[model samples]
Target: MSRRVVVTGLGGICATGANVPEFWDNSKKAVCGVSVRTLKAGDEYSITLPIAPIDGFEDRLAEFGRDMARADRFTQLAIAAADEAVRDAGVDFASGLGRRTAAIVGTGIGGQTTFDAAYLAMLKHGRKPHPLSILKIIPNAPASHMSIRYGLNGPAFAISSACASGAHAIGVAADMIRSGAADAALAGASEALLTYGAMETWKAMHIMSDELCRPFSKNRKGLIIGEGAGVLVLEDFAAAKKRGAKIYAELAGFGMNADGKDMINPAVEGAAGAMKTALSTVGAFDPAGVYINAHGTGTLLNDPTESKAIRDVFAAGADSLVVSSTKSMHGHLLGAAGAIEAIATLKAMETGVVPPTINYDEPDPACDLDYCPNEAREQRIDLALSNSFAFGGLNAVLAFRRV
Candidate 1:
């Protein structure tokens, strides 16, 4: 059996959009979901800053059943996204597909809200943590919940690679399908780390923007934290085609590597190498038709580094390609960044309208690539790549092409 992989459905929820269609629509409109909000750990501790938060998501918890409601917010978000993906793919797991499907969800910081509450309660309130705190705080909670929820009996687990977690999970799931380890997979990531403790920790690093995320801009401040989940239903290409599935795009290539140099600094060499490796399987492609969903974190070090990497990979043709950071609109989803960005990439390819890198006030000389500026561009897209580079120099790139 040939084990080629394809993305049949995409589901996502974020500060930008509640689902894939909404996300794509908002992307085309260049809608910015980031806003100023106050997060408080207790009465004594509070911080106000710009954040991309998905408000009113709690109202939808009843639809996920009791188990998901009891799970952490990350798990809930994952289930919500997965529900949409499974429906959109029209896959009937009850018809023996569940046994051969894998649930591979990723999270950079699992159950952060639960962890924060537990510590705060124990330290300040003189109270014991909940008995289910261990289970809730486990990184694999979302994966396990998904497996049980979907009745999946194949390989089920979670990947934690900081910001690269989503891309790593999706790529690994596709690889498993290609290797005959599974026939299909629920592949994506979820993150709900906008809790007070997580925010404080991120603020301590001095890498968060107080206002907007302006990627590739000369006056770029830093990334803003966001919370949400993005899920994709991936299946074997042969099987999906045989069943007349609505194929979004073929999962053509994946490349991952660790820089091994510094935890904080991203290396241009590692990023360029991964991108090259991913393109290795893509055959010959026109740079003009390529759309790169860049890992443009809008930070002091990331924008220029990523620009140089893209230029190194594409060389003279770099100017022909269009690159954008949807993070400028949705804010950085941390672990969920790659999954949603992959969706954005696929949507751009499918619709032939590239999302804009919004909030781009000033351009930097070092980052001279065409970012599509503050407005979305309409162009034919034959290939798309979603770039994800984590804080630990973990790099993952995914390539997709129309089938």
Candidate 2:
């Protein structure tokens, strides 16, 4: 029989809040994380306004006055968040042994900060970069750091699927437990791509917000880029119950797909495919019984397309279901979006209150579905779906049920 996997702990460090509790409380208030950028020299790149940069963030992490040489901001995020998760899950990796504990973290842009710094240093001084520069710059560095730090003794790997990386990492880790690869797994994604080149790349796309991110709004402008990380502790149901661990929620199902036709644009068929697959994984589930955390980047192309896809998949509950975009409060975390949004979904389940999509001034014709606009609402949701669709037509959806 396939083993059951459930979420025991959640850790998130993002624009919303540092820890899970703080993050959940702030999200309940619909606090927008978008702010002005000082790095761009007065609107420097592709996405200027409403950029979600982490404030008071320490890129250099030194626990005992000895810094991890050449560590990047992205790796720091993973470490911080993972520390919280492992602690919350009550697992001591240093003392524990032979339990098949593992880690699977995801990243879309790995060490962009390290890569940029190395290039500039070479140009300015005409000298070779630091020896650990490459080690800090790899996409898998975050996952590697996590495993080394925690001393997990099972399989460890990194998942990269644009915005879908986090969800894929978590889902795949759950399967590891079910298939006897590990008794538990730490899963999520970390990303800090607020570098100059990342900003320039978004600017080239011209799909960033000028004023602010406005999801499900008629006057919606565009999306705002942000940075952060989120991590989760997933363990076999029997093992967690044996340990008397507090259950946060059950990661009921996961669905993923890519648009075969487009490199930049999203295909509606692929979107529907992912949603349908997610719903089908859990058999005869009612769509209205759950809340939804939308990707809702406030882009013209993404918002409407997402709305239509949801309607098609949940036709049974399209009119009454509550769906909102926490991105209005936390901004878009790119590769980390899925994991952070998953935390939001779990928060709604725990608190019994669904957060809102802020900045909803006017309603878009295409985005006519309910978005639980402008304020938090009281709702006892048992099941919830989080949607994240990224560039290159990558789409992922995860369904979580209250335990």
Candidate 3:
């Protein structure tokens, strides 16, 4: 028999805020968190780009003590977010429940900082790297550290599907609960790729924007790289209700597919298919009333492709459907984007206020839709969809309904 899953707790840290509340507050206000930062390529050259980095994260490392010294920055952010999520859920993992809980995290470029440092030490400086470099640089370190921290013994793993990593992680974790593989799970994603090497590579790709992110805007150039983590505690619906947990929203459906055609370009059919599948899983709903947390990367291709996908999926209701990209405010969190955007979607449902796509000046005709631009809207969101389309044509869509 299949079970239903619901979100019980949410915890995240990003450029906008340190936790969910702060993140939501700043999001609702449409505050731009992208700022200029200097990244050193080695010891000689430095490049400046607008990035959304979590401030003061180094000071918080002291809370975890010596054990964290060996973990990478990405894993550190994941552990901190997970700690908040566990505490918020009020789940006592030590009381036999730990055996039934799992940890699944996602990362696009995990431990880039550690990798960059190790490469520089060995190749650039002709010196031996740190002994723990391997442990710190692996993409699965976040999931492993999270599992070890909470003593969770159930299925634990990491997903790394470019930008879709976070949503995929959450979707897979929910599937485990529905399949009775686990009663509950800590699921989310983390990214700390704000290293010089990572920045240089992104720059080489010609996707890094110098100005602020302007999703759906005609003058929009590209995406600004950001780093952070977002996590949620998902529990079985019956178990959560029995424990009197405050249910945020029901994770109603999840759908994903690959575009098979291109590496970086997105396909309209693929995006539309994912959205259709997710909504189909939960039966019918008023398409006009649905809101979309778009994977709007402020790029020329993604914005219009996503817009066309929504139009194709909703057809007549496309004009009434509201879509917004909080990435315009929080910047793109890459692997962590979907998880943080999921939290924003649920918060919008809870508060009856949809966050806006800031920096939208002139909308392109190709991307014509009701993008809640520049200001928050007072609307009741009965159902919402969060879209994540990655570089390798991987697409994941999640559906949530107000409980």
Q: Compute each candidate's TM-score over C-alphas.
A: 0.99, 0.94, 0.98
Candidate 3 residue spans exceeding 4 A from truth: none
Q: Write the per-residue lDDT of candidate 1 for residues 1-403, one digit (tens) a residue.
A: 4477999988999998888899899999999999999999978788889999998999988988989767889988988899999999999898999999999999998999899999999999999999999899898898898889889999999999999999999999999999999999999999998878889889999999989999999999999989899999999998999999999999899999999999999999999999998998988898999999999999999999999999999999999999999999999999999998999999998899999999998979999999999999999999999999998999999999889
- Candidate 3 lDDT by residue in tens digits, 1-403: 6999999998888899888889899988888999999988577768788998889989889987676877999998988888888888898889887899989999998889888898888988898989989899889998898888899998998899989999999999999999999999999999988888888888899987899999999999999988888899999999999989989899999999999999999999999999988888776678667899999999999999999999999999998889999999888889988888888988888898999999999979989998999999999898999999999999999999877
**Sort by lDDT, best first: what order?**
1, 3, 2
Residue 162, model 2, lDDT: 82
Best by lDDT: 1
Candidate 2's C-alpha lDDT? 0.82
Best by TM-score: 1
Better of 2 and 3 by lDDT: 3
lDDT string for model 2 (1-403, tens) is: 5888899988888987877888888888878787887553224233334588778766435651233445888888888888888889886566563247878888998898877767767875587887888888888887887777777778888888887888888878887888888888999998998887778777788888887888889898888878889999998898788889999887778788888888877777888788777777565655667788988888888888888988888886888788999888888888888899999888898889899999998877899888989899989988888888878888888888776
TM-score ranking, high to low: 1, 3, 2
What does the lDDT read for residue 271 in candidate 1?
98
How does candidate 2 fare on TM-score? 0.94
lDDT of 3 at 391: 95
